[model samples]
Target: MDFSTMIGHDTIKNQIVNSIKGNRFSHALIVTGENGIGKSLIAKEIAIRLLGKAEEKQYVDIVEFKMSKDKKSIGIDEIKSIIQETTKKPYEGDRKVIILYKADGMTEAAQNAFLKTIEEPPRGIFIILLCEKLENILDTIKSRCQVYKLNRLSEEEMLKFLNNKFESLSEDELKAVSAFSDGIPGRAERFLEDKSLMEIRDTVIDILKGICEGKLDKTLLYTEFLLKYRGEWQEVLTYFLSYIRDTLIYKETGNKELIINIDKINEIKDIAEMFSFNKLNGIINIIKDTRSKLERNVNATLVFDSMLVKIQEV
Candidate 1:
């Protein structure tokens, strides 16, 4: 896709365009952002521009390196193959672009091996490393590349993007998507494509409403529901946190517009009336703590149980 069509990151796009125009584009570039933040899309756009090709046509000169689905880390052997490939001249254009997806997944050894090529890249070779974590890249490797970080879009920007992509969504749906996407375009797309995610979101909202209504006996039942979607526990927690945040916002501002879960305004109002600001804040804190614990590989069952109990107590 054209950079103009991409949502947000106008500054970075302009810089890239200017750099290409000036014929002073860096041989190695690093693109960093959280998952679903459009790092890959940006990298691909750069490749298309660099190769001077139409977006619909595949260019032989553009090479992408991605971690295998079965592999947790990109090993040294893969880097070696890429290094060998770099020795060959571009097949279809004057410039060859190597786009490494999830470059942070490269092991230290693989990074060190890959570093050799970027340190002294072949003529007309451009290396774009897409990473979620900048710290995972070697300092030496980072020093040799120009780093561009992608930040989350504003709510307004996200809403515009959603409107452009999905015309059928209602105003409330747009607002919910903008808030749920957390300003990430790719995430917003996922929400549009994955109906199951919407189901999970609804379930989480129901669970929160139950909690707000003092359904203590249903705590275990809620935990069981969460466990059923263990693979998506993070998403479940994010949904929980978001609704609680909306409740808190409503409680404090008394403005329906400020709430993210706009479709559930009535439930949010009920929640706001049922709890004080301190209690709402306490629940938010508890959700954050539970998320932290889950990230640490804590027992999911215990964490969920404890989180429900803590919320009830609050």
Candidate 2:
């Protein structure tokens, strides 16, 4: 993809394009951001452009490695191979581009090996490292590389982009997609892939309903659900928090635009009426704290139970 195709991060894109135009491209660069924020796409586009190609599909000498692979824990051997690959001349292009996805997952030895290469990189080769977290990288490696941090797209910008891309979609549908994606373009695209996202969303709402109605025992079952889908719990929590916030907004302002859970607006309205504003605020805080604990590797089951009990009491 070209620069125009990239969504959001306008300033970063301009900087990258200007660097390439001025022939001042850095030897090693780190593109860091959350998943679905287009870090890889932006990195690839910049690499392709640097290699004198308008598109990635036309690049023959470029090598790409996605770090999500089981064998993707970039080790010394992989770094050695990368070094070997970049040392060679480009097959058909002016530059050999190595696009490393999730470079933060690199092992210590691998990072050291990479550091040696970065200290004296190949003249006509470019390396772009993509990572979700910059903290995992070695200080030496980070210092040598230029870093581009991508921010989350704003709500209005994301909504406009989605609407223009999906013109046939209704306003409410677009809003739901935009809100659910949380300004992440790749995740907004996922809604198109998994059309059942609405259903998954409803499943979460049902779980919330069970707790609020006191139908399901919140002791162990909640924790079991969390453990079963550890990766998705964060998303579930975000949706829950957004739904509650929308409900509260609807209650106070009576505005539908502020409500994200449009499909269950009635249920949300009931929930808003059931819980006072202070209670809702407390629950949101509890969920946020629970999320932080989960990130710190706390026992998921225990966290869920404790959070559920606190929320239930309110």
Candidate 3:
């Protein structure tokens, strides 16, 4: 894809383009952002430019490293293989681009082993590390690379991007997508393409409506319904959190424009009326705590049950 098609992060893109034009691009670069925020796209663009490719496709000189399907973390063996690969010259171009996805998943030993290669990379080798969590990357590795962070786009930017990509969608649908994506272009794309995600989002909204209407007796049913999406429970929680956040914002400011979920304004107003600020704050805290527990690999069944009960109480 053309770099111009990208939605945000213009400054970083400009800098990289200028560096490539000047032939002064760094040997090692790190791009950090939340998941689906276009880190990989940026890396791909850089690789294409560096390799003098006219289109976005797999180039013989562009290499990628990522976790195996069965692996939880990238281990030292993989890093060793990458180190060996860097020794070879580019297959089709003057330069070789090595892109590492989920680089933060590299274990300490793996990072230390990879550090040796970064410290003294072969001539004409460019390394790009794509990471979601900057804190997980070792300081030594970060210090040796030029790091760029990608931030979420504004609503206006997101609308422009969606309009460019999905011309079939109506204005209301576009606005809803902008709200649902929370300024992430990749997420907006997913919401448009993934029907199951839309179902999950709708279910979350329904459950919140029930909660606002004081349907405490359906707490168990809600938990059971959520449990069915255990693999995507985090996303479910995110949807829940987003709706509640919008409700809280509307309640506090009484400004419809200031809230996300704009397409659900009536529902948000109803939810806002059903709960006080303290109650909404309590529910938000509960959702956050539930997410933390899930991330820690706590028992999913128990976590959902407890979370539902707590939210009902709130």
Candidate 1 stretches greater than 4 Å from native: none
What pairs collide in candidate 2? none
| True-structure RMSD, every candidate | 2.0, 2.2, 2.3
Candidate 1: residue 128 Cα off by (Å): 1.0
User: What lDDT does each candidate get?
Assistant: 0.88, 0.80, 0.88
lDDT of 2 by residue, 1-314 (tens): 56686568999999999998999889889999998998978877887778777545746677887654467488887788888888899888668888888899899888988897886788888888999889999999999999999999999879877876888888788888888888898888877676455545776676666666765474346666566667677676877787888877987998887787687888887777777888888888989999899899898778878887877776
Q: What is the per-residue lDDT of model 1 for residues 3-110, given as tens digits with 9 covering 90 to 100?
A: 878879999999999998798899999999988898988888899988887664567898998889999999999999889878989997688999999899999999
**Deviation from native of the Cα of residue 308 in model 2, angstroms:** 2.4
Give the distance in Å from residue 223's predicted Cα in candidate 2 to where it truly belongs: 4.1
Clashing pairs in 1: none
User: Ranking by TM-score, best first?
Assistant: 1, 2, 3
lDDT of 3 at 156: 87
